[model samples]
Target: MATAFYSHPDCLLHEMGPGHPECPERLAAIEDQLIASRIAEAIERESAPLADLADIARVHTRAHIDFIERSAPSEGRAWIDPDTSMNPHTWRAALRAAGAAVAATDAVIDGRYENAFCSVRPPGHHAEPARAMGFCFFNNVAIAARHALEVRGLARVAIVDFDVHHGNGTEAAFAGDERVLMCSFFQHPFYPFSGADNQAPNMVNLPMSARTPGTAVREAIDLVWLPRLEAFKPEMIFISAGFDAHREDDLGNMGLVENDYSWITEQVRRVAERHARGRIVSCLEGGYNLSALGRSVVAHLRALAEI
Candidate 1:
């Protein structure tokens, strides 16, 4: 079976500000590398559909949804937090970003694809049930995981996050839910400053120091995350695939490189093949340096496509 790649042009229309790290060009960079490296021809491409409000409401409150809807600006940017904002096209773009994740989940579950990757963004993971923060508008992975469990009738699912920062919003969404198992590692004392203490039993939160190397990350995954995920025996696996931990990225001080992402994806793939019929859906979370982001995504896709 082929891997599906989900994205939309609408996602490129939303931008926070002039020099913001999370800009539309991030997607363009990935596209450029896909073409330059010939990975574009290897995977199946699909356009992302807009998510229904009901689907979004599974993880976010109706009031929060309404707030985002009403917050769309007519001309300039409307700030949600100091670092997050909405432009005229942001409302539609946010829907497309989340919609990509949900659509990819369905495609993988239905066996249309062995696995999938969503390249859309206003990058989610920080957006909570009642608030949007840290360059996120909706918790896309959380919403899709809920959909798999509640709407699609899956008994178990797992979420893996490897962003430089903690996935506070995703943690909030599935903290106490036994049906979902979340494994994540992020820089300690970092932005959002979460996932360090008081994590639920189902969540394996590993906080590393600023200069932690990829070897330590891989060891942690093998020692900690793999055991929990193996025990969970998830029917599907979801990844909050953030590449900002790369050494070239200025957002964080982690020393991860392209090979690190490929290795991580391979480990996740092995688990998927063992228990979940190779079902995995990965959505883009963060990667600021355009060159590094593009290269890292290519490495991730090569592993996902097994090429």
Candidate 2:
């Protein structure tokens, strides 16, 4: 089955500001690389639908959803946090970004596609149940996981986050939930410093030091993530695909490259094949350096598409 690619034009309309790292151009950069690599033609494309308020409410508080809706600006940008802001189109963009994850989950679970990649943004993984931070308005992966459990009747699911920073919101959402197992590695002493401690039994969070290389990531996956994931035997797998850890990205200090992204994706794919029947849904989270992000996404898609 072909990999489903989920995105929306509104994702390109949610601009943070001038010179912001998490700008709308990031989606275009990935598309440009997809076309250049000849990968776009091989995949199935679909427009992301708006996520229902009930779907958003699964992982976030109703008050939080209402706050985001009410917070939409009429003329200019509204700053939610110091690093995150919203333009006029941000509300719809955030919905589509989250909706892409839900749609991808349905496609993969229903066997319409074996796997899916959500290329929408206002990247999630930073937004918590009641708060939005790090340019994230909603926890996209968390909502997808919940949908798989509640709506699709999935008993087990796994989330793998390889961002340069920790998926604190994801961790928070499934902290005590045994149905979901989350494994990840992130640069410690970085932004939103929290994942190093207070880890639950179901969460395998490894805190890598600054300037850590891809070797450590591979070791963590081999020694830590894979073992736990294999034991979990998840029915579906979710990925918080973040490429900012690439060595060229100035957003964070890490030594990952395109090859590293491909390698990690292959490892995840192997896990999905083993126990999940090759069901995987990956959502874009973070990646700043435009060239590195584009190249890394191509590598990731190549692994997901097995092409």
Candidate 3:
């Protein structure tokens, strides 16, 4: 069984600005590292398709979908927030990003691949049911989880978000939904601060302080996330694989390293193997430092591919 790597050229066309951290180079960095690290040929690469409005609507409101479509600028940038913006290609790029997740989910479920990784841009996990923020326009992982449940009739799924910021949008989409379980850790008192205050039984959101090290994050995952995931016994696993928590990434103040990400992927893979028949769909989220992002993603892929 091989890992499916999903990406598209449209993802490169959607840029916030000239020097924004979440630039198209982020994907290029990943590609460069994949080739440099010899992981490119180990996985199967697939171009992402445009996500259908119905699939996106499984997690986002129709009004929100309409707004995103209407928000595309013809020739200039349109600001969604202070840190987020859109160009003419943003709408299609966002759809492809979400579509990669959905398609990856189906591939994993159908056993076409052992697991998958979606390396698309306009990284999701921040776009709420009706609001877009934090450099995201749609909740990609959330939509994929919904597809696994609503379309595939899976009874349970687990969402693992390791981004530096809280997945407030994903939480908004499935906070009280018992069919889904979301586990995450993020920098506290940071951008889009909300996970620490959440008390949902199905959500295991750990808010670590700014400078928290990887050891602490690992402890929390081992003691908290793994136990809950084991108990829930999800039929499939979805990972919002963000690398901004890397110590070198200036986007946030966390102390995780490439080895930490590899370890985290291994842990997640173990759980997936145990409960989900090794069905995992991981999507790229945040990691601004190009070098660190590239290295971290390669490490993650190595772990997922067991290479």
Error of 2 at 287 (Å): 0.2
Per-residue lDDT of model 3, residues 1-307, tens digit only:
9999999999999998878999999999999999899878899999899999999999889999999899899999999899999999999999999999999999999999999999999899999999999999999999999999999999999999999999999999999999999999999999897988846999999999999999999999999999999999999999999999999999999999999999999999999999999999999999999999999999999999999
Which 10-residue window in model 1 sums to the lowest lDDT? 97-106
* Cα RMSDs, all models: 0.6, 0.6, 0.7
In candidate 3, what residue range of length 10 has the lowest lDDT sum? 191-200
User: For model 3, what is the C-alpha lDDT against the true structure?
Assistant: 0.95
Native RMSD of candidate 2 (Å): 0.6
lDDT of 2 by residue, 1-307 (tens): 9998999999999998899999988999999999999989989999999999899999999999999999999979999999999999999999999899999999898899999999999888999999999999999999999999999999999999999999999998999899999999999999889899878999999999989999888988899899999999999999999999999999899999999999999999999999999999999999999999999999999999999
- TM-score of model 3 vs. true structure: 0.99
lDDT of 1: 0.95
**How many residue pairs clash in model 1?**
0
Instruction: List residue ranges in candidate 3 displaced over 4 A.
Output: none
Global lDDT of each candidate: 0.95, 0.94, 0.95
Q: Tell me how far candidate 1 lies from the true structure as C-alpha RMSD in angstroms.
A: 0.6
